[model samples]
Target: MKTTNYDIIIIGGGMVGASLACALADSTLKIAVIEGREPPAEWPADSFDIRVSAITRASENLFRHLGAWEEMQRLRVQPYQAMEVWDATGPGHIHFEAAELGEPNLGHIIENRVITRALRQRLREHHNIDYRCPAHPKGLLPLIDRAQLQLDDGSRLQAPLMVGADGAHSWLRQQAGIAVAERHYGQTAVVTTVQTEKHHQDTAWQRFLPSGPLAFLPLPGGRSSIVWSTTAEQAEHLLALDAGEFMAELGEAFAHRLGAITALGPRGAFPLKGRHAKQYVKPQLALVGDAAHTIHPLAGQGVNLGLADVEALAAVVLDAHRARRPIGALKTLRRYERARRGDNLLMLDAMGAFKSLFSNDTPGLRELRNLGLDLADHAGPVKNLIVARAMGLDALPAASLATS
Candidate 1:
């Protein structure tokens, strides 16, 4: 088998992996990005993708830094100015505005395909990056001085550092024998695009129900993207419903906040699970994105968390390279681990707590949460801080690529 060498071997070329490559564009390091599947050349402009993400301002900063944000905007993106969260069980509600945060807008609602496409396009501009699509890693080996990946075609790639950005079921993580702790939320996230009777008003709305949270994220037009988290049985029921019935139920659950759902697009559902690796780094290896941790989508922090990993890992790796230190050394990888592991765990735990707190129907618990929401709404400073964190401002600063 022929062998190829790279300064870094990224085992997945999804958004996170691809963004990492772009983040290191100015570096002289030779990199290889192995991706199993390739995204479509272009998406239909008239229809929207069912899979979408709420991109925080910090994430937007990273994309802008990478030179992909403009293209994404050209393709399609919705800038949501406000977020409204309420407890359906009580009269407790909280709202956050971009003006309060001293920002242009809170975040963006962009299709997953749009992000991937834009990142992929950016990947092509970096001369140091070798992107291999329709390629799968058959195996991975962590060596004393290098980590190696064996593709199904019998080609091998070696690098001082290897990254597992493949996803929750990370093949690289599994091959390297990293253990993961997983908790099934026993809920499924049903996602789709819909046209609302009332415009979404460029606002993000989430209503907590006994079953789970239903979020309506604004889109470019009067359309909105919805994520409905609910029990498995109920999810199946929702999926099985015809368009009319589903729209009726959806409108009712959302309290017609956006008025009726006049039109429906394709629907998708995936099981929700919280997974965190026992360790984020090992000799000659590191993990990022869903490979490192996954949280419930109720908060839409999944991709933001992944982008933060990209920022931190890129910074540490660039720093190491400049210092002429071993980028893959355990000591060096640990820096990235230390910077991200604690934060990821904190988010996972918080999501779990929110899931438990909102999914309960106890009258007293409902009242307490409603009161908590009320208090939080009135607590301006505290609320702004929380929203800022969500915007990726307060917690982790954007990654710096300048040689330190």
Candidate 2:
């Protein structure tokens, strides 16, 4: 078969991979992207994609650096000025306002599809990047300095660095003989959008119930996007409900905080599980995003975590290339792995702790957590620290978090 060579080949064209492509666009390195799905031709400026994320200021800055944030802004991404978290069993609640941090907004809630499309557009503008859609890597062979990839088409590509941004079931990671530690939470996430009777006032709200956490993220219009996490059986039942019944049930579930839920869009459910690869990099291969680790979406930091991995990996690769060192050298890749492993583990542990803490039915534990929230709310310095952490400022001291 024929063989083409590239400086780097990324095996997933999702936001993380595409952002990595864009970040490396200005460099002379030749990048090839292998994606199973093609990007949309155009983004819907006013519509909402069922999958949305609460983008932190740090992630937003990374998007800006990649030249995709302006396009996201053009697509009418909604900036949430405040976040309110409460529990059903207690009067304890907490509110985080962006003004406390001297920022205009806490974070931006954007449709996943819009961000993906914008990243694709940026990738297209880069002459050094080559994107292959509906393609898969058949196999990978690591060489002394570069790695060779065998595509399903029987074609071959060689690169000094090979990245697996594919997902939780990363084919590249498996092919590299890397093991993963996975745990099934037995929960599923039901996501959809609703047209509420009252405006959200640019506030994102989350309510902790005995079953799971339900988040109402404000959209550009008066509508709100809902991410409800519950057990598998419960999620299936929710999905089985008719539009009218679903809206009614959802309104009741949410205690109608935004008033009556008038309209409901299509609902989709994704099984929730936690997985982290035993190793993030080998001789010439590295894993990013979901391929490395996946956390619960209860905090809405899943995508942000993936973006952070991309940022860190890209910075390491760029630095190595500038130093005239092999980008895929074990020493260089180890730097990326070491820098990200602790942060990833920290987030995974935090989400797990939060999930276990909130999922408990014990009265004492409930009271303790609720009281903790109330205490944090009443303590100004504590509240500021929590808000900063949630805003992605305190997660890691990477250069990516520095305000531009």
Candidate 3:
């Protein structure tokens, strides 16, 4: 088999892996990014992609630093100035406005395709980065000093560090003998784009029903992308319904908060689960993105967390390389793990608690949650703290300076 060598091997070319490569663009390290499938040359300009991400400011900074933000803006992005979250069953509601916090906007919602397309564009400009699409990993062998990956083409690539960004079901994680703690939420997220009778008004609206939270995130052109998390059975039923029937049910469930659902786009569904790797690093192998952890989407922080991982890992790796240290050494990689594991765990637990608290129908619990929401709404300091953290501006992680 043909053999190639590199300083770093990144598995998966989704948003996370691609972002990591871009984060390291200034480095001299030879990097290989392997992705099994290639994205389309272009998406339909008239319609938005069903999958979208609520990008926090910190993540936006990282993209900007990588020089991809301009192209992304040219393609399309929707900025939400405010957010409204309330309980569907009770009189509990909380509103967050960017003006209240002296920020221009809460965050921007962009389609997943836009993110990947932009990142890939940045990858092309870096001479040291080799993005290999249409390549699948067939085998992995981890030695004391390096981990070797065998692609389906019968070619082998060896790297001092192998980073897994392959997502929740990470093949690299499994090959490295890393185990994950997983929780199946027994929920499926049904996603689609729709036009409402009322304009979204640059706001993100979410209602926590007994089943799960339903989020209406504004898209450009007065349309909204909806993520409705519900029981697997209910999701199946919802998908089985005709477009008109589904739109009617969706309108009723949302209480016509945006007047009515006037049009529907393509619909898709995926099961929900929480997963965290038992170990984030093993000698020459390390994991990032969904390969490290995945949380419930109730808070819309999953991609943000993954971007933070990229920033932290890039810092440690680049710092070590500049210092003439072994970037793949366990000690060197541990810095990335230590910086991210705690934050990721906290988010995972918080989402789990929120899901438990809001997904129940107990009368006493309902009253308590409503009261808690009211109290939080009234508590300015507490409310701002929550929003700041979600916007990823509170701690100011390596994302702000990692590329510098």
Better of 2 and 3 by lDDT: 3
Candidate 1, overall lDDT? 0.90
- lDDT computed for candidate 2: 0.87
Candidate 3 — which residues are off by over 4 angstroms? 397-404
**What TM-score do all the candidates reach, one by one?**
0.98, 0.96, 0.98
TM-score of 1: 0.98
- Which whole-number lDDT from 0 to 100 does residue 391 have in model 2? 83
Can you tell me which runs of candidate 1 are displaced by over 4 Å?
402-404
lDDT of 3 by residue, 82-112 (tens): 9999999899999999999999999999999
The clash count of every prediction, one per candidate, is: 0, 0, 0
C-alpha positional error of residue 102 in candidate 3 after TM-score superposition, expressed in Å:
0.7
Question: How would you encode candidate 1's per-residue C-alpha lDDT over 178-197 as one tens digit per residue?
Answer: 99999889999999999998
Model 1 residue 192 distance off true place after TM-score fit, in angstroms? 0.6
